[model samples]
Target chain A: MKIILDAMGGDNAPDAVVRGALEAAKEFGVQIVLVGRGADILASMKAQGWDTLPDGVELANAEDVVDMHCDPAAVVKQHPNSSLVLGARMLAQGGGDAFISAGNTGALLTAATLLVKRIRGIRRAAFSPVLPTKDGHAILIDAGANAECTPEFLLQFGCMGSFYAQKALGIESPRVGLLNNGAEDTKGDPLHREAHQLLKRAAEQGTIHFVGNVEARDVPFGAADVIVADGFSGNVLLKTMEGTAMFMSDMMKQMFYRNPLTMLGALLCKKGINGIRKTMDYRETGGSIVIGISRPVIKAHGSSDDAAIRGAIRQAIRAVESGFCEEIRANIGQMILPREEEHAE
Target chain B: MKIILDAMGGDNAPDAVVRGALEAAKEFGVQIVLVGRGADILASMKAQGWDTLPDGVELANAEDVVDMHCDPAAVVKQHPNSSLVLGARMLAQGGGDAFISAGNTGALLTAATLLVKRIRGIRRAAFSPVLPTKDGHAILIDAGANAECTPEFLLQFGCMGSFYAQKALGIESPRVGLLNNGAEDTKGDPLHREAHQLLKRAAEQGTIHFVGNVEARDVPFGAADVIVADGFSGNVLLKTMEGTAMFMSDMMKQMFYRNPLTMLGALLCKKGINGIRKTMDYRETGGSIVIGISRPVIKAHGSSDDAAIRGAIRQAIRAVESGFCEEIRANIGQMILPREEEHAE
Candidate 1:
């Protein structure tokens, strides 16, 4: 298997990206095509004490970088040769099995959607991130690919996310839930009400395991394996979790550093505390996947280091091997509304 | 000031409610009218070792209780004699300075909106909860009052929330921010985009401290004093915070209890750990106030104990004395869209 890695993306690039790609190529036994300025990639390798490239690793030269300050819509047009745009183009042409980027999220997503393209019947591509839950983890779709969405779009997300969870996360018949203000079927705005009915219908047809509406408060408690929402609400949910996790960690640090006794206590409970940290760590879950695209396009965190990039690459390999996208493509018929009257709106 | 409390509401009901009312009357030097079944109130008081009704304490017989399982829209009509309904009516008729309920949130909101009514010109009442932050706290408006909202409703929420934070929270010229997916003027769906402009206009007109858009991630950092959101997003933010905090606290407890060494560390740093708990404590913040109503109507946590009820009563006293509602009433003309074309939506 081969993966296209955006060598110039993310904060630590091209150093972390280069090293991560090399490590992934050797460890995962996959061929990696590193796309970026060849000079910088080589320089980063030298900085990390790597004198030569591995046998399975190759470099594809792309000089420019996508500027985050530019408009997301105009990124691909403005920086045609940027690593993000080029990597996406390569993936589109079947130059590689999957693509990975940790640079600009909006730019990467924009490039991927416009270049790699979504599935034939998918309404919109989505950014799906696996969130750490009390029991294990749950997939949150549309973390911010489409700010506004229709009921049909939500129905598609439920189906697509369930497929991703079942294949990539190794779950069987994943339960899908609509993220809403309340769990009641009758609760939420008109859009949610309609979406709930559609999801319920799909569940009745046995297309997916629709678990009804789920409140955001119950999300962390592992209420469902797949949580579907519009980009706005999903983004809000994802960011709130990030902020709260950081805040809690900060508070815990303060608690542990209060005095000598607390310091000793922290040392004694170091193992347990480390376990909590590992569980909440974003990098532990690897990169977020931009689901519904024609090929696997993973978005690593902007500040990702070599370890996170390596993890993202590993995820890319799994995504490519899972055939989740093919499943979604084949089951597209079940993701849409059958009512003609609904389409008129 | 006299505070009317729904004694037959919340998980603890009469036991916690009556004990809390008696405590508030003694400690805060305020009169409290406990609304519930007279016999149950007396029984609770006696159970708590209170031989008689204390000075400045009174009871109004309310034979019925609002059931949360019933339809929220039909609550007042179904439970006209309920503590929540009677308390609201009493507040509307100037029978008490303020009213508070730890009962069904929907029923309390419905009763307050229908009986007390919103200040004239107010679009919709909002549930404004004061959320704890790293620095201090921020007020999140329209937590779940209206699942669906217009730009105008959001605009009103901004003005109302600003006034609320300034008066009740004792913040001078409190900064108001529209909750959004991104921290940009052009972020979010159409509702947020238009609301952002409206809030900017309000700020330019010197009506409020509009601080542009605030993402959910920035909320816990005390980014703004008043975070305005449509009810759906606000509820999501509020509940997400609650869930994350609980999840973190639970993890910490597990960590401390993991082994003898960890237990010793926990004991050593008890003060700091307690401090973190106090900061994140729902009881410390008291109850959430439904803003824009003609009279102050507070919604305490349904699971509140005697301490929490006492805290809610103290908050009610502050809300009644602050004249925040009057501020909103006076500035109603400013919290609207100026363009006619936008109103047509």
Candidate 2:
């Protein structure tokens, strides 16, 4: 399998991206096409003591680079030869099986939708990221793709997220849940209430394993395997969990470093603290997968380091190997047809 | 000051409520009127081995009790003599200066809105809770009151939350922020984008200290003193924080009790851990204040203990003494007038 990497993206850029690509190529035994400015990419590789591209790895030079601050909607149009645009085009043109980028999220989404395009009958694409929970991890769909969503959009998210969870996470029948303020069907705004009816119907048809409404408080308890929400609420839920974890971790550090006695305790408790930290770390979960696109597209964090990039690459390989996109394409029609047919009837 | 308490509310009601009322009456030198089933309240008081009611404390008869499962909108009419309804009526009749209940949130909001009513010119009342942050605390308005909101409602929430933060939390000029998916003005759904423009205008007119959009990730780091969101998002944010904190705290406990070595480490780090726990505790911050009401009303947590009830009483007294309702009423006109006039013009 071949994977295209946007080496010019992210804060660490050429250095971390290049190192991660080399590592991923060795580890995954898959061909990696690194796309970026020729000079910068070569300098980064040389700085790492590489005379030439390593085995299973190659470089595709792109003249332009899309800055993080540029307009996402306009990047593809303006920077036609930018690394992100070129990488996406490579995946669309069958040069690579998957595309990975740690760039501006909006730009990536824009490129994916405009170039790779959405699956047939898919109204919108969603960003699904695996978030840490108590037992394991849960997929939060539409993490920040579309701010405003209709009930139909959310129902599609539930189906897509369920498929992603089953194929990617190896869950036999991932329990799909609608994220809401309360567990009752009557809870939440009109969108959620309407979506609940559709999700229930989908569950009844056995297309998706629909769990009832899951509250934000129950999310970390692994209440559901695939937690589906509109982009706005899903984004808020994912970020709030991240922020709270960060705040608690920072507070823990401050407490340990406060005085000599606490320092001694920290030393003894280091293993356990590290254990919890590792569980909470985003890098361990890899990058967010942009679901609903025709091909697999993974979005690494903009501040991704070498390990995060490697993680993203691993996620890309998994998506490609699992044939998750094809699975979604095959199952989504059945999942959505009943509702539409019922409406027509 | 006189405060009305719904003794028949909450999971630990009657017992915790009576004890807390007695404690508040003695500590704050305020009159406390416990409203509940006459016989049940007396039995709970006697069970605590209190032969007589304390000075400045009394009881009022409320024969009915509103269970948590009932519909919030229909609670007042269905159970007219319920403790929650009676307490609200007492506040409305000027029988008490304030009302506090650790009951069903929807039922409380229904009773308060039906009885005490909204402050004139306010589109809707909001539930403002002082959530813990790194520095101190920030007020999240419409925490779970109105699940659906218009731009006008959120703008009013900003005004009311700002006033509450200033008068109650003592922030001279509370920075009000619209909670959105991104910090950029252009980010978020149409509701947020429209609210952002209005909030910006309010800041320009000096009605509020609008600091523009605040993302969920920044909420825990003291990003803004007054965070304004529609009830659905605000409820998700508030509950997610609480849930994350609970998860972390539970993990910390598990880590400490894992083995003998870790247990000793826990002992040595107990002070610091307890300090962090105290900082995250909701009891320390008291209950959520039902803002935009004519009179001060507080909704304590349903599972509140004596300490939480006491905290709620303290918040109620603070609200009553601060003349917060009058403050909101006085400035609400200016906060809302410009938007209406602008549309008209």
Error of 2 at A320 (Å): 1.0
Number of clashes in every candidate structure?
2, 0
Docking class of 2: high
Locate the minimum summed-lDDT window of 10 residues in model 2 chain B: B336-345
Best by lDDT: 2
lDDT (10s digit) by residue, model 2, range B4-102: 999999999989999989988999899999999989988988999988888899899999999989899999889999999999999999999999999
Per-prediction interface RMSD in Å:
0.9, 0.9
Measured by TM-score, how close is model 1 to the native structure?
0.98
Per-model TM-score versus the true fold: 0.98, 0.98
lDDT of 2 by residue, A1-345 (tens): 999999999999989999999998998899999999999999999999998998889889999999878899899899999999999999999999999999889999999999999998888999999988899989999899999988888888999888888887899999999999899889998889988988998888888989889989989989999999989989999999999999999899888888888888888888889888988888888899999999999999888899999999999988888888898888867555455644642
Docking class of 1: high
> Per-candidate DockQ versus the true complex?
0.86, 0.80
Name every residue pair that clashes in candidate 1.
Answer: A10-A103, A265-B265
